[model samples]
Target: MKIAYFDNNATTRIDDLVLEAMLPYLKEQYGNASSVQHKLGRQGSHAVEHARIQVAELIHANPKEITFTSGSTEAINTVLRGISKSYRTIGNRILTCGTEHKAVLTTCEQLTKEGMAIDLLKVNGLGEIDLQALEDAIGPETVLVCLMAANNETGVIHPLQEIAEICQRKGVLFFCDATQWIGKLPLNVEETPIDILCLSAHKMHGPKGIGALYIRRKSKPIQIPALISGGKQEHGLRGGTYPVHQIVGLGEAAHQAQQKFEIATLRDYFEAELLKAVEESSIPTKGANRLPNTSNVLIKHVKTAELMTKLPQVAFSSGSACVSGDRDPSHVLKAMGYSAEDAYCSMRFSFSKYTDREEVDSAIQQLKEAVAAIRAHSPIWEMYKDGLI
Candidate 1:
């Protein structure tokens, strides 16, 4: 039995080119990137710098602005913690949205314990933030406003230009956890007025343990103190030896994604055809601007877990991969005004450029069968048959 993968929002399979590019670093070219004396060390250092250039191109940022870390989680921690410490004299409040990944939320929670005021901006029914509300949240004590470029679960895109303008007008630092698209979507940080940006490599077909944070180092240097201490690495922002293979893989992945970025309309067709076959199913945020490859689907009257279990060969997710083990309904869905039952019945299906029409068609068929098998056992389905719900 062949398996169908539709959980790309969680993580992507590393590209073949990325793996090929990492071979030398893992094998014969093993040397520390920080060592500048030996030939092997020079080779490793050169590769690391070249990878920085490649990754920088994806976001239209200066190579000097990028600081590589373990991944987005570390990158987020670094930015939040560094800013929390550096900006203590400047302000005490940090502004962010409610629908951010646990990474940003958890970091904010930590800062609150240290007496920083963490204010969560609310989103509308479609999982979108109110621009006016964002503007209202900024005050004299506002040090930073952290928002994601795209949601990880629902794929709803925030209006970056407008949000940037608000932050700029108020003279507050703007930080974006653009993990969803740092490796995939075309971004121009210079033109967008973003002060800081962070993203991971794994989301865009790169290695898992590598990521970068972009701090605008233009006219006046943006000050963010180092979170880790010891040796001088990542321009003294982060300390430790670089993971050579992972960094090389991330660079190759960024190059490949830039060269082969395909924005096809398969998601529309997938949702249309899937909805036609699977009656009463809904596409969350269907009326809003969402990522081209994501679909948060609600197959009403059928529990997503039971449906997934019935179709063992199909691989998807009930929510964000971070909360995969949690039995509670998705915090994102609940924030969008979905009832607990509706949230439990919803699953996220994502597609990559590699996802073909044949695979989507097969997944739809499997979904219909799974829904039928599970709904047959549901008391709610019986009530629906009697026009009770």
Candidate 2:
């Protein structure tokens, strides 16, 4: 049986066009991008530069400002660690939201242990940060503000432009982890005052193990020391032999993502139908603006772990894939005022442009049946029906 994939925010299936663009590099054009002494190396270097341009074009950034990394995790580490080290003389504090990805939150925790003051801003129940709280948090001791464009679990979008402006006015650098937002939505660095940004290719239908970090070089260049230093690669920031095929795939994915179709209709339909089918189901982040392809639903008294086991043909996530192995409830939901039980019961279904209506219907039917089956054996559900605690 063909599985119904709805965990796109974790990763997407590599597009055929992206694969086609990468195969040549994997087979015949396997020259090292750094070994530019010979014709083959020159060819590899040229291809790498071309891919840089393609990736930059997707975000309306200058090609020179894009630095390739292993993925968004490395990119995030590069920005957070590099900025913290390079700007220590200027400030010692870093501000970030409570709902940011583990890539950001984990790095910040390390920095805090290393004597850097780290402040986590609280988010409302709707998964939005208060702009006034953010602005007030920036002081002379603050060097950087780390925020994500979209929450990986709930898909709630942050006010990026406004946040960037606040950081700019306060003379603090803003670094946005756009891993979940880059290819799905249009972002222009020229219009927004974001100082640094990172995205992974696998989240955008490209091959895994490739990503890019964008640093502003236009007005006043955002300067930071190298995170992984050895040889002169990625502007001496991240040094390693470039994966030409993966870079090529990332470029093609960015190119194709420019024309990706709007998928909100299918997602909305899925949520509406599921809510109608499952009793007492609720959308946790319904009030906030979310990604067009993401729906995070909460079913009271129905544990997602139990429901997931009943529907083996379906693919979804209880939270971000990075920490899926951990039994703890979703940190994103907990940060948004959800109880641990509610967070554990929530399921995230992220769609893609290729997701069809039939798949949504099938997933909904399977989920409804699975949820009913789980609730039937749930003593909590029995208590809920009997109007008892």
Top lDDT prediction, candidate number:
2
TM-score for every candidate vs. truth? 0.97, 0.98
Candidate 1 Cα RMSD (Å) = 1.3
TM match of model 1 to true structure: 0.97
> What RMSD does each model have against the real structure?
1.3, 1.0
lDDT of 1 by residue, 210-238 (tens): 99888998676777887777688887888
Question: What TM-score quantifies how close candidate 2 is to the native fold?
Answer: 0.98
Tell me the deviation in Å of residue 325 in model 1: 0.9
Q: Distance (Å) between predicted and true CA of 102, model 1? A: 0.7
Clashing residue pairs found in predicted model 2: none
Cα deviation of 254 in candidate 1 (Å)? 1.2
Worst 10 residues of 1 by lDDT: 256-265
**Residue 380, candidate 1: C-alpha displacement in angstroms:** 1.7
